[model samples]
Target chain A: MEILTQIFSLETLSSTLRMATPLAIAAIGGLYSERSGIINIALEGLMLAGAFIAVVVSYFTGIPWLGLLGALVFGGLFAMIHAVVSIKYHADQVVSGVAINMLAAGGTVFMLNIIFNTSGTSESVNALPYWGPFKPTVYIGLLVVFIAHYVLFKTPFGLRVRSVGEHPHAADSVGIDVEKIRYICVGISGILAGLAGAHLSLGVLDSFREGMTAGRGFIALAAMIFGKWTPFGALGASLLFGFSQAVQIRLQGLGIPTEFVQMIPYIFTIIALAGVIGKSTPPTAIGEPFEKGKR
Target chain B: MGVDKIDIKELAIELLIPLLAIIFSFIIGAIIVYTFGYDPIETYAALLQGAFGNLNRFADTLLAATPLIFTGLAVAFAFRCGLFNIGGEGQLLVGGLAAAWVGTFDGLSVVVHVPLAVLAAAIAGAIWIAIPAVLKAFLGVHEVITTIMMNYIAYAMVAYLSLKVLANPGEIKTPPIEASAYLWRFSNILDIRSYMNLGFILALLVLLFIYYLLWKTTIGYEIRAVGINPDAAEYGGISAPKNIILAMLISGALAGLGGAERTLGLYHYYIQGFSPGYGFTGIAVALLGRNHPFGILLAGILFGALSNGRTFMNMAAGVPIDLVNIIQAIIIFFVAADLIFRQFIPNKSEGGVA
Candidate 1:
């Protein structure tokens, strides 16, 4: 009974919230871009860019919030490269995203080599203040989910974005600037992803390690898909994956085959994508480039 | 128009696009080098020298390329059939594990043990790929997400097996396979001190086999038909589902063969992190090669040269070898951005037609 109580304690729940925050934020980011008819597979790369920028800024400025701002700016700028490639250059969305990811992976380490005089990791910097084991961004991130839900469902801009995503021809006929909407949404998503990266660097860990986000950005993508691209659903899925992350650490302490435990969220994501958990449908124009005057 | 004229036109475009992409990549790399306060011309010269300095260096380049050829072909073959197999890394992992596991038990003769180990790897790779293929075909799940998920799972499973189940305690890798399971090195036969092995020959054979299969076989025709237009192929009585599954299996097998090369040819054991993003690099190789068997061979060799030379560039130029990866990334980005490609080239279709 004591073991069970300890296992289900608030501390474990708090850790789960911490783990989920990045995923939730990134998923919401993906939600906006996908809803605007662009595939944003560069989320991973954007997150990495953000993480690297956050750490570097925080280390230099001695201010964590400035790090977050720097991360957002860099992350948005990095994502713009993907946007130009996918939207203007008419690149295969997946390939462009993969390139962005590779750039982030390599470029960040390269920058680390220059900035910190090392390759694998950055210097340890001051982390963000905590509100009883939770960073301020944790609350901010969770709050953004609700804000995202409201804006996506309630606002006119949300309707315009959805219209562009679903039937671009119709949206164009209706005088909607599809490309403009897509650029904005993609930019916003990039900022969100950067914030998620900032959360990882400034909130969870003080230093940024190479590939430290590991597969979190990809996992956040899975969560977005698992939730059927809905902000609330994405939040729910992210929390679930986060809970699994918390449990995996606990299982490690119990001497279980913790490697398998580490795999649970990914496995669950596969199952979710397989429609065992629920059916998921992506935006109709998600991977299609919006060419003007073309049906 | 004469067939020869059309063929020449196609060839010109094909060669031009990749060349332009490479030039663009290096230009970007050069700009970045200058920004970082390095001499771009000197760096590129050093890169060239490092890659093809001598026979031994050339052999090292090919040795690095051997696995890439297998993995690149895996990605290219699948792409020919409209399937995106980002799961080559996972297939390679399982296949390597299978080869290592099979190698653990060996009193067999040379022919039997080597064949058995390679076959184990191929089958293991096939089995792993089957999961995603089935999920995609039957359940309407996208292969991209499933394959990516499988990669993490594969990594985790391999980590577990190597650490807990098959560990040679205190060593970071499993026990070295017996002599019978080894892939022979050309260097050994010639008494040269080099890692160059029979795996390059194997990569060459696989390339030829794939080229033949894609161009000559009825199955290959069906696969191409489905890839070009799945609905039309279905209307014309080709089973799109079946071809997708078959392509994935073949892709998986090719990747598995790569794993076999890594275990039997290179390490003689399944070391942790044996694959240094070779699977992902295969995607760029396939694209840069224009998904042609011969093109993949060329791209694979070029990448191998880049990989081998990166360390030399780091030591000689005071630049992080990560710059090579950045160059590779830029190349892939250009490949993806067809509009930019079209803008520069002016009158060419996508790579397939070119």
Candidate 2:
């Protein structure tokens, strides 16, 4: 009974919110990229870059906000490379995404070795300023989710983005610049993903570790799919994932084996995904490359 | 009369792009090395020596290539059926775990136990992939997301089973397999220091099997037809959904065999971190091979050489192993953007035949 009580405590709830914040931020980012019809599988790499850059800049400048800003800038720059290769050069999206992931992993480790004289980890710095006991950052992230939801369903640009994803040919025939929309959406996705990484480094751990993004990008992707790709739907999905993670952490404290607890979120995700198995559909042009001459 | 000349020109044009792409990437790699204050010639020389300097090194290269052949075939097989099986990592991990479980159990002869373990792995891998295939075929779910999601599930499940359920109690790994289940190393008889064994032969056999399966079978014809145009294939009396599932199952089975070979022939036990992204590297190998069995064999060896050389390069030249990864990234970039290279090399008039 005590163990059960501990599992359902207030501390667990707060931690759940904390864990869910980054995932929600990234899921919204995935939402934008998918809505615009560009499969942004590079989200993980972009987030990793953002986390590293955020730590480096913050360590040097002693300004967490500046670090966040640096992450946004660098994340966008990294994402631009993906855009150029995928959108402009017509590279396969999966291959380009894998390249980005490998590049990020190797590049970060290389830079760490050169700059810090260590393997793939950065030294701890002064802790970043917190948003207060209420944790203003969480609220802000939620607000962004709401804003994104409103924009996606309410605005004309949003409508154009969805049209582009569903049928690029039809969208182009209606005078929409499919490439331009993709560029903007993918670029913005990078910024949001960067923020998520920044939150992990500055808000959660106050340091950078190699491979720290740790498949959070993929988890966010799952959340987006499980949520049916809508912003609010994604939020619900992320919260559910967050709760599972929180339970895992709590179970770890209760003397139940940590490994078994760790399996909960992943197992639950697979089962949840199974629920939407044949019913859920992605955008029509999700993985297809857009070519002007092709019918 | 002029058609033959046009065909030759077109072939030359098509070949030129990939060649230039390779050269350009090598030049770029050289520039990066130079910027780091390393001599490109010496580094490359060392890389070559490390990869092929001795029999032991050559064996290491083959060992590395062994599993890649399986995973590469897995990816290529799915590509023929128009499905991108990104869940190779998950399938490989699951298959490896299954092999490890069966290999450790006692009371079976080597001949029967070894084959049984391998079969268990293949079946497990097939089941692992079947979920995504069913979703795609029946539920209209995009396999890209489903497969990627499955990877996370597989990773977690493997970790859990390794630590709690299947753990050897004292250690985080399972107990070693019985001697009968082990794939004997050729080095034992040859008195060499290399780890090369029957696994390489098995990989070659699998490659031959894949080639025959893809090129000589009616089912292969159905898969290709569905891949090229599912609607048309259905119109032509092929069952698109059935082929999709079959392709995934076949791909998973190949990946499973790769895992089995690793466990039985190489490690003889399952350990964490056994796969250093072999599944992902297989994607590049398959793409670079152009989905041909012989092409996959050569490409897998090339990648294996690079990976094996990186260890030697790290020891001899103080070059980081990460450099090899950078090379891989460059290769994938070039391969994925092959059209970019094609544009620079002017196409011949006869190339319009396609």
Candidate 3:
């Protein structure tokens, strides 16, 4: 009885929202790219890059907002490497995504060595201001979810994005620029994933550490799939993951091993993929390179 | 003679692409170093000296390369079956734990104990990937995501077992295995005081075995057929689902052998965080090697050299070791986007009419 009360407390709810914010934003970001037929396993890399950029910018400028902006721009720019390789060169999308991840993991630490002369961590910087009990990015994350749903479903641009992902040939025959739409969608994913990173470093923590994003980008990817690649679905999935993490934290002192708690979200993701909650399918042509004349 | 010449030329082009990608990645790495106010030549010279300066360093390189050879084979084998296995790390960890547990068994001879521990590791690795394999085969879930999720689960589970269940008092590692389970190190057999073990030779034999298996066996034929075109293979009576599961099991077994080598050959026990991304780096190794056994051997040695020498590069050249990772990433990028090479060597098939 006491455990149930502790698990359902207001503190857990607030922590859930805080943790879910980054995941929700990143899932929506991944949704944009995957819906446009580009597989983005690089969300983890983009978020890490964004976190490092946000920390460096905020450290230099003493402004958290500017750090957020820098992260967004850098995220989009970094994602273009993936876009050009997979889109223009017709490289295998998964291979390209893996390269992006390795680059970010290496590049961020390399830059840190040059800038801070330290390898493990950077100096503390100004963090994003809080609004009431939560940071502003938390609220912004909620807003982005609804806006993404409207833009992805209710708008013609969204229709084109969906059309390009589902059947690129049909969309191409109808005069839609398949490559262009894919590029924009991938870029948008980068921007949103960058926001997710900024939320981690600036909104949640104040300093940048090596490999600090851990596997949240991956969890966001799982959330995106678990949500069936829809914005609201992603939001709900993120909440479930966040709630598990919150409860995991709460159970740390209750004699339940922390590692067991940590396994919950990943286990849930595997179970979800196993068709326990119905079939979760991706966009039809998600990982294929777009060719104009090829059958 | 004309046919032989054509085959030779095609083989040359295939080999040339990876070589050029490596060279280009180094040039980019040099540029990045120069831009950051470091002397690229000095840094690379230091890196080379550190990697091959003496017999000891060379042995160290081979020692590091051993597990990579196994993990690289793991990834490459899965690629042959048209699967992306991002679960090598987890499989390796599980295998290590299994070997560690088996090594704890007392009163066994050297031959029986060693093979028993190794077999246990391989089986554990296969079992670890079984869930993802079954899901991918039956339900059509992409192995990429499923395997990655399995990796996280493995991390947590291993940490728990090592930290809470099997850990020695006040240490984050399991108890050392019995002497019977130890893989004979070169220090004991040869004059060199290095940790290089029989695992290096074992990896070489495994490489040859994989080559023979892939090129000579009917099972390998079916696996490759499925990888190239699953629908066609299925139409021809090949069981795609069966091959998918078999390929994953083999891949996982290879990864497990890597973990077993680390435990039985090097550490003699399972330690928390024993791997420094050997599994993840295997992806880079597989791609850069063109997913071939011999190619993987060379790529594994190169990566092993880089990893072995990075600390010296850091201390002697005043260059961060992370630069090696940057170069590795650039290598994978170039390898994946080989179309960039079209400018240097024009495509022969471009202008021919079908």
**Per-residue CA lDDT of candidate 3, range A45-82, in tens?**
99999999999999999999999999999999999999
Q: Tens digit of lDDT per residue, candidate 2, span B130-249?
A: 988997787656677777777777787888787667776768777788888787787988756777778789889889988887778898888888888899899999999999999999
After superposing candidate 1 on the true structure, give the runs of residues whose Cα lies further than 4 Å from its correct spot: A253-255, B1-7, B346-354
Please identify model 3 stretches exceeding 4 Å from their true place: A253-255, B1-6, B350-354
> What's the ranking of the predictions by lDDT, best on top?
3, 1, 2
Provide the TM-score for each candidate, comma-separated: 0.96, 0.93, 0.97
Runs of candidate 2 with Cα error greater than 4 angstroms are A1-4, A134-140, A252-278, B1-21, B348-354
lDDT of 1 by residue, B1-354 (tens): 331145766588778888888999999999999999999988887787778887778888999898889889999998998888888898998899899889877689989998899999988888888989988777767787788888889989999998778987777799889999989987876645668888899899999999999888999988888888889899999998999999999999889888998898888999998898888888999999999899999999999999888888888898888999999999998777755766655555454321
For model 1 chain B, the run of ten residues with the poorest summed lDDT: B345-354
Interface RMSD of each: 1.0, 2.1, 1.0
Write out fnat for all predictions, comma-separated: 0.83, 0.61, 0.78
Q: lDDT by residue for model 1 over A164-216, one digit each (tens)?
A: 88998899998999888988888988999999999999999999999988889
> Root-mean-square deviation of each candidate, in angstroms?
2.5, 3.1, 2.1
lDDT of 3 at A82: 94
**Residue-wise C-alpha lDDT for candidate 2, range A32-125, written one tens digit per residue:** 9888887888888888888888888998998888888998888888888777788888888887888888888777776666567676679886
Name the best candidate (by TM-score).
3
